[model samples]
Target chain A: MDPDTAIGGGRDRFPSTEHSLLEAAAGGLAPEALERVAALYWKPVYRFIRLKFHKDNEDAKDLTQGFFSSALERDFFARFDPSKASFRTYLRMAVERFAWNAHAAGKCRKRGGDVAFEPVGEDAALTESPEEAFDREWRRQLFRLALRDLRKLCESAGREVEWRVLEAYDLAEDARPSYAAVGEQLGIPETSVTNYLARARRTLRKLVQDRMRGVTSGERELREEMRRVWK
Target chain B: MEVNSDPADLSDSVVDHLRQVAGLPDLSGTRYELEGEIGRGGMGVVYQARDRQLERRVALKVVEAALAGEAALIARLEHPAIVPIYEAGTLPDGRAFYAMKRVTGVRLDRYAGAGRPVAERLRVIRRVGEALAFAHSRGAIHRDLKPQNVMVGEFGEVYVMDWGVEAVGGTPGFRAPEARLDQRSDIYALGALLQFVLPAPAPAALSAIARKAMSAEAGCRYGDVEEMLADIGRFEDGLAVTAWREPPMHRVARFWSRNALLLWLLTAYAAVKLGIFFWPYR
Candidate 1:
């Protein structure tokens, strides 16, 4: 068997875990999968926030914990169906939403009074010299993670139609084939392919929102996360 | 080919080896032939190596996978201002490794001492500014736009290396003093470079502009890189008084010599007239 075909290689796994978690969540084992993936992913997500925002330890930790707690309560993992998007992408979108809330809250607090939070240490080890390209790449990576999860989730759910339309139009590196060609391949009209892609995008957006439910608490938080993740 | 569900194949061995190598315990891999150390920074050490398959010289920079992540950030980037990242993947030990074209050039700080004349130095400075502007347009802010980060090749090609501390809109290095590290950060650095490269007076004016751009109060500074570039133009044209003013050291020497020459000429004329009067008395 081609081992490379698996999700993440041995010792470092995600794809299988995500699948099992999703299935478990769907089949009443969701509680267990939810806890496991959350436990595994929380710190990584927190670290991302810490590094990207250079937030203090407390704030980073709080956001990290809050994101997972919200996810559990909101059924983020339980709602996973490859029919919508990939889990990795789902997590990133969740984190982005979390960041926006934290940022907006921080701004609001600053307006009211002195926000007393220590800065991340000056000695924080930097891998690259500070350059704008570095930051853009970081943002792009987050985008890619969400996109990857979306692609994988759809493929897994046997939603080959929606998945293929998105894959050909949005994800694939090459220029998209004409709608007619795509239609011929998918056994749908060229117009249908375009229409399908549009619908698929909306589905992807909803999937992201669904995932956010597990990561955020209320309607306000959900809306904020949705905006952040979608953006 | 049959698909394997085993996780082993999903992760690359190269990724693991690199992770271990970067983490400091040591590296023992035959797949990657580490030739020699090229450079070292906060992130990782760069090695010049041979790609056994392609048989081409490539620079390998090993970083911590956990810190670096699944996709190599450098690999996805392309810019004239940035060193091109060619490929990235994880080693066996989960170390993240990135490869790029080997650049042969002197750091910007060393460029000035390379015996290049003033015009060449200014050109290098301008080129660096242009590169910074390009990256800024992509919403990338180079917080550390110092001389050392800029490199100049033998052919006068300039490249900006190290985007490690970039602030997107506002990243860590974008201190309140610089306010927004965007293109203005590069502009400040360019202004500093102009001070060093351009003739004396030009530096002062350029420095003033730089100081304004880098002002802690963001409102008082040039809004963007375009504005900064326009200021550089003003300096180059000698319109910037602080930058183009004659050095005080030259002023004193020139003033003394001119005054002495004038006095000597006037004395000579007076002596000739007196001599004419004396000749009449005789």
Candidate 2:
């Protein structure tokens, strides 16, 4: 828990929120918005199935896809009442309810009949509760989304210097380079390394907050989520 | 530069590092070691950082380089109430920052909320007024003066924090309708700040001063912070203020309140003299 990880991204909207996702579901379940939700949430859903339902990797993967397809067809997300609970909590409960009913009925949906998404890797250290696992995976997938967006941001906006600074300083695969060394490597002033890194980090923070906003129902929920996860 | 749609497989440590980097203002190249955040505002976040070379704790206002003019602004005017900037530089993360003496105390809003006597609150607000006056004298307008921006220390010292030198727009409630930042806008903020610090049953004279300072029209407000402070001075001294036309009864009451000790002594003396004069026809 880094002390610096205090919740602070004010007003940065990248994509949308869970409210819009529900609205999209109501409006014939817009495929694009649903796909974004699936991409962002598939890992969390799969992890929840694996940890909570005691499913093997293949079963969890199949159930994960089935859950999304089933929820999509059944209009599960549209029933979210923001006042009752957070979208995250609502989602977790929905998954649990769906899994229990399916397991009791001795039913298995045909595989490969749903939205395709990246599978959650072997997180064998499931010493924590299922809820905690789902939340952790949610945060991890959030970072991945932000990282993916950052890559696109740098490319589209020609922010290569900022990206390079972030890579050399923070995302260094090996030993992190010194500012002077990075400056020499990039053929820019030593000071510019930090300047660019600052820009990149600011952008990254906004993206992360934007992702947080996308999952939350409103500004208040987004702030609560930021505090819950970051702190 | 070669662009990839995805980041190279991010490890757990990478995510951890990203979390720190996203929230923390990296100060690797600078002497200040960030302890924790003090607070944040529109301009930037203020962190309680230790100046390694000086071996003392200072507040580092870590803001974007574009919004880092506060250092130079404070540097120009050396006033006791204005938080003094010690050094200014760019953090390793490239955000421009300025290190200043970290005055430990409650914000004016919190301090006011503590239910201090109106006179005590008035004294602190007067100091805040003086600070704004000094800045205005130096041809600089605070453009953002509110209870939250003023710091009241334990030793009864007040420092106006968060100059917001680079910020064009002030906070909503305090800011005047005037779009431009000027001395009058600062006066408007000062009035709002004055109103915030005052207790609910604020005295008529003092409330009048705040009301004049916070007048909707720019010209209707104080010509300068000095004028507002002068009216505040008059209110404190039990003299007639320019802002309010005090009725004779309220004026007499104010006079009595301000000179209670002297008036009490005079009344006692007059009673003794009258007792001696009327003493059995002596």
Q: Considering every candidate listed, which one attains the maximal TM-score?
A: 2
Tens digits of per-residue lDDT, candidate 1, B206-233, equal 5676566556555666666667777776
Using Cα atoms with residue i matched to residue i, what is each candidate's TM-score against the true structure?
A: 0.40, 0.56
Q: Write the per-residue lDDT of candidate 2 for residues B87-112, one digit (tens) a residue.
A: 88886545688888999998888888
* DockQ-based CAPRI category assigned to the predicted complex of candidate 1: incorrect
lDDT of 1 by residue, A129-229 (tens): 32322233233333333344456666687766876765555543334367777678678888778666755555554443344444333333343333333
The global C-alpha lDDT for each of the candidates, from Candidate 1 onward, is 0.55, 0.74
Q: Which stretches of candidate 1 lie over 4 Å from their true place?
A: A1-231, B1-32, B66-77, B165-183, B193-202, B238-282
RMSD, one per candidate, in order: 17.2, 11.3
> Tens digit of lDDT per residue, candidate 2, span A120-175?
34554647888987887777677777766786788799988788778777777566
True contacts kept of each: 0.00, 0.27
Alpha carbon deviation, residue B202, candidate 1 (Å): 5.3
Worst 10 residues of 2 chain A by lDDT: A2-11
